[model samples]
Each structure stands twice: as structure tokens, then as C-alpha cells.
Target: MTGLAVVGVADDTDGPVVHLVTADERARHCPDCGARARRSKDRRVTRPRDLSVGSRRPRLVWAKRRWRCDELTCRRRSFTESVPPVPPRKRLTTRLRAAAGAAVADQGRTVVQAARDYALSWPVVAGAFTSHARAVLPAQPEPVQALGIDEIRRGRPRWIPDEATGIWQTAVDRWHVGFVDLSGKQGLLGQVGGRTAQAVIAWLADRDQAWRDAVQYVAIDMCTIFKSAIRRVLPQATLVVDHFHLVQLANQTLTEVRRRVTVTHRGRRGRKGNREWELRNRLTRSAARMRGEHVDALLDELSNLPRVIGAPITVAWNAKEDLLDLLATARTGNRSAICCTGSTADAPTPTFPNCSA
Candidate 1:
């Protein structure tokens, strides 16, 4: 390539460089007008970085010429020759711009870093990154049938008071197979108001009717806002309450059991040291002991319950058993059985047998 002498050469400690000559046969035509006006009014030379020629860093030596138009009725009297393989009215070469774009888009590097690496201005680097991202980023996906909504706390900054804190909410649309972060905002739903029902509805409204009809099930916690949104948008879909929220209700009941047991035991005249400690220990061991394969441990613990706190212990034990029964009923795939346990009073009687599920 060095044998083809279309331009001059400059060698430095950093790299080998080549310059473009405007006096060549190919350089005579005006780039803007595409006219063969060889009479040059003015000339300017610019050196731009190019893709590496073999092992050596190559440079595009540009020779810009302002040539007078020979046509009488042309609006402009003169125009510059257009450079090949480079963007018009831009100094940086296409190869350098592309490298800068890759650095920003693929690597998440800042425009400042990209500019410094490519030896370009900040705006040039930013423009390249933006252009590349616009070209490559995937279009927003179609909506799914099922959706999940939840809120997350946003803590106060060190500069702000704790009471003035806010939160960033998010919603997820659960497809039968997988889930998508359909926060209704661009680029994966990372928005401040993303958790609102309005935002979710807005997102669904943008999708096609086929996508809307494809939804068969919508699973979410019992948030009224979310429920309202789901009913409004997916009237035909079945709304399934998330299992985790049901479990949480049962957990809350267990907490109430602890409180009630503590109160009832303290009312006894002689209950102070051993008796109180035993009751507290029993309450703590309830769920932990029953978890997974520790059912035998739980049974053994329940069997050895102290006679002094037997009544409260029996109440908690019965509640846990009822809860398990309810869970079994829900998981049996019978819609009628599940529907029968819907009311707060009828379902898990939040007292002696708190079947929370």
C-alpha cells in the first residue's frame, strides 16, 4: 500500500502517517457539486486516523479544495470536494469514529474516555456513541399476558433527612415461560414511577391486540392498584395471587401467636423465669422446626411442650396444621376448593386456627 503514492508521508515516534494530495487526477472534481472544476480557490489539509494498515497505524491524508462552479445558474459559486470513506463536514475518519462508538456502546465507557482514546472531541465521541446505539439497540418487545407488580424502597441520601425518603417501584410482566421488565419506560423499565398501575396499563395499551389476547393469566400480590390495572387491561385473563404473599400472611399470623402466647403466660401469677423462657422458645421454634425435612423435629418439639403453657401451644400448633391443610387444598389444582377459602373470616380464621393460605 505504501507503494501507491497518492499523497505525501510523515513519520514520527508515535506512528507512520500518509497525507492526501489535492493535485491528483481523482482530486480535481468538486465533491459537493460533482463538477470537474480543477481551478482551486483555496486549499486545506487534514490528517485523520484510519484502520491500521497491516502492523502500522494508518492515517487518511485529506486535501480539501474549494472550487468555483462553472455553471451560471448554480446557487453557490464554490463548493469543496467530498472525501470518500469519511462523513461530510466532519474531521475524524469513519474508522476512528466507529472505534469510539464501540468503546461507548459495547463497553459502557464514557464519551470522555472514548474521545481521549480516539483523540477526538467530546461531541464527536458522543455523536458516534449515540448513532451506534440508535442503530444497534433492539426495538421494544411486545407485551406479555401475565404481569407482576411490586415496590422497592429508595433510601434517603446522606444529604437528605430520613423522613423525606421515596421509593422506585417496578412491575414485571410474567409470560408463562419467562418474565420481562415491562416498567413502561424505555430500555428495560428502569423508571421512578415504574411500579404504578397506570404505567403498566400504558405499556400494555401500546402493544397489539394479538399480544393482549394472548395473555391468559396475570399473577400478582393483592395490591389494589395492581388488581385494578389488571382487571382494566386484561379483563379476560385469570388473576392469580402470588403464593409468596399468602405465605407472608401466614408468617404474620405466627407473629401474632408469639405475642398472644407471651401475654397469656405473663398473666399467670408464678410465670417469670423458666416458664416464660420455655414459652418464648416454643414460639421461636414453631416455623423453623417445621420447615422442609425437619417435620420430625417439629413433632418431637411439640410433643415435649411444657404442661404450664399447653393451651397456648395447642392453639399455635392447631393454627399451623390448619395452614398446612389450606396450602395443600390450594395446590390441589381444584378451583372450587381454592375459591371456598377466599374470605378473611372463612379462609384462615386468623385466631386459633389461622389458616392464612
Candidate 2:
């Protein structure tokens, strides 16, 4: 089918074997120098793996030629023949490698899974995907307008014992810093080893000066290290703090409030059948997400509970709702009246103790 002459075909222990050779033998040009070589140095045999044909996989054994380059000026050496379906220094055919790469990259199969499907070793499949990625994907991109910085934990924390004191020091094994380009379609820029200022600055420093100058905005969390690094390298760029962390902070504050209210009112940790414990999750949920009927039902349920139990929980719930409202209104670019002004015209503040600012 590939236009190569089929010298022989036989059944082997490994399935069907197809012996192939080049149909037309012609003089080949020297790879280093363009000069043609007419002399044959030797002939070699290569067995490259091909794709499976239906349920049976055919092994391709190719008879290859070697040519002697007679050019005096050129670094003269004997070069081997390169034919269709098999490139130089490769044991697998082009189609076989491409199939493995597509399984891993395009079809989202793991390396082990792709290896099993292709009937190849795991390392072979993984190397094919790596080569395909390098060939097809762009190495460097134009400067990103908006970059987002985040970190991911590598593994669970470990405790190292002190030799003398016998006290264990807690340590996190590995952390990676991920940079994302928010300006264009290419989602992830790359990742660095550690989540420190030095690691980020070193990655940025590798880019050209023009690329660095083109960066306009950076979005990061409340980490001072990330902010400090960005301020030094891209001073002109605007730093926008990520709002997701703020919402997380608000949720944590609500939990703390719930715990404190539980301790003060009941003189113990919350347990089953407590109204505050029952409605804990509902309390942190935003007012905008709650239906009118649901909110009314919850408020009625709270009003009927003991005043000491219901009052503190209501305050925390209202504060959480207010924070969500503030964030939502800010997102839409619309102004809403602040609820915490110390005046009769303003609404009463929800008594969350730790969330003043």
C-alpha cells in the first residue's frame, strides 16, 4: 500500500511479518553536503514496528542501503538510507508514533493506558508524545498582557526530627509556581520550581527585554512575596489582587464567628439538633443565591429558636450576605448603599467581630 515492493510475507511467532525493500534504487545525496554519491558501502536490515492491521499487528522488516560520500572537501562518511514510514535512528514507524502521541495528547489517555492500547512500552509512548509536543507546539509566545500567578502543593507535609532536641520540624516537600496568560487563548504559560519571589523573577528574566516591557497587568493572590517580585520587575504593570481569595477569607471569617457564637451561647462546641449547626452552610451562602421563599423560611426558623442561639448566628449570616452583595455589585460596576455607616439612615451592622475592614 505504501508503494514499497513486498519481498516476502510469512507468519511468525509474533503475528504476520512483511519483508519490504525500496522499489527503485537510486543514488542518494550526502546529508551534510548536497553532492550525490553513487557507491554502495553496505546493506543493513531493520525491523520497525508498524500499526496493527485489524486484530493482527504486522512487523515490517526493511532492507536498507548505505552510501559512501566521495566529496573531498566535505566531512566524508557513509550514510544509511531513510525510507517512508521509518525515519533515521527510529525503531517505530512514523504512523505508530503519531498514533501514540494522539492517544496521550489529543485523546487525553494516560501514558500507561496509551502504551497498553498501542502494544508498546510506556517509555516509548511517553517519548513520542514529548517529541510531538516539541515539534508542534510553539516554544516562546509574544508577551502576555495579563499574567496570573498561583501555587500548587506537590505532596503531603512531612515532619523532620531534630537530632538533639527530638522535636520534629514541619516541612512541605515541594511547591510549584504556575503562571497563566489571561490575555490570549494559550491558557498556561509555564511553571517554575518554587513559589518564591526569586523563582518568579528568574523566569521573567529569561524573556527578552521587549517581551518584558509588553507585559501590562499581573493578577496574584494576597501573598506579599508575589507582589514584591512583580513590583520590582514589572513596575509599570498594574497589579490586580485576585478576588477568589477574598471570598475564601470571608467564608473563613464566618466559620470563626459560628464557632465563637456556639461557645458563648451553649458553653460548649456545637453538636446535632443545634439550630446554628443545622443552618451553618446555609448561613455562608449568598443572599443573591437564596430564593425569597427559602430565605423567609430560614428567617422564620431562626426567629422561633432561642434568642441567645439565633441572634448571634443571624448576625453572622447577615454579614456574610452583605459581603457577597458588595462583591456582586462591584463586579457589575453598579453602586449600592453601604450598610455599615454609623448613622440612623444606614442599616445596622451585622455583628461579626473579626471582619471590621
> Model 1's lDDT to the true fold?
0.59
Positional deviation of 14 in candidate 2, in angstroms?
Answer: 4.8
Please write out the lDDT profile of model 1 over residues 1-357, one tens digit for every residue.
221246567887667667765444554555545567847799766665666555667666776677787766556678765545554576666767888899998998898987876667898888888788777765545454344455554443223234546543323322112233332233232223345677667766766778778776666677786678878988997766655676567656665665565566665343455443444444444354356656555445545656545455556666765665555654444434543434553433211111122
TM-score, candidate number 2: 0.68
Model 2 Cα shift for residue 335 (angstroms): 6.3
Worst 10 residues of 2 by lDDT: 348-357
Q: Considering summed lDDT, which 10 consecutive residues are worst modelled in model 1?
A: 348-357
Error of 2 at 292 (Å): 1.5
Q: What is the lDDT of residue 49 in candidate 1?
A: 62
Q: What is the C-alpha lDDT profile of model 2 across 231-304, one tens digit per residue?
A: 99989887776668877787788788878878887899888988778887887777678899999988888788
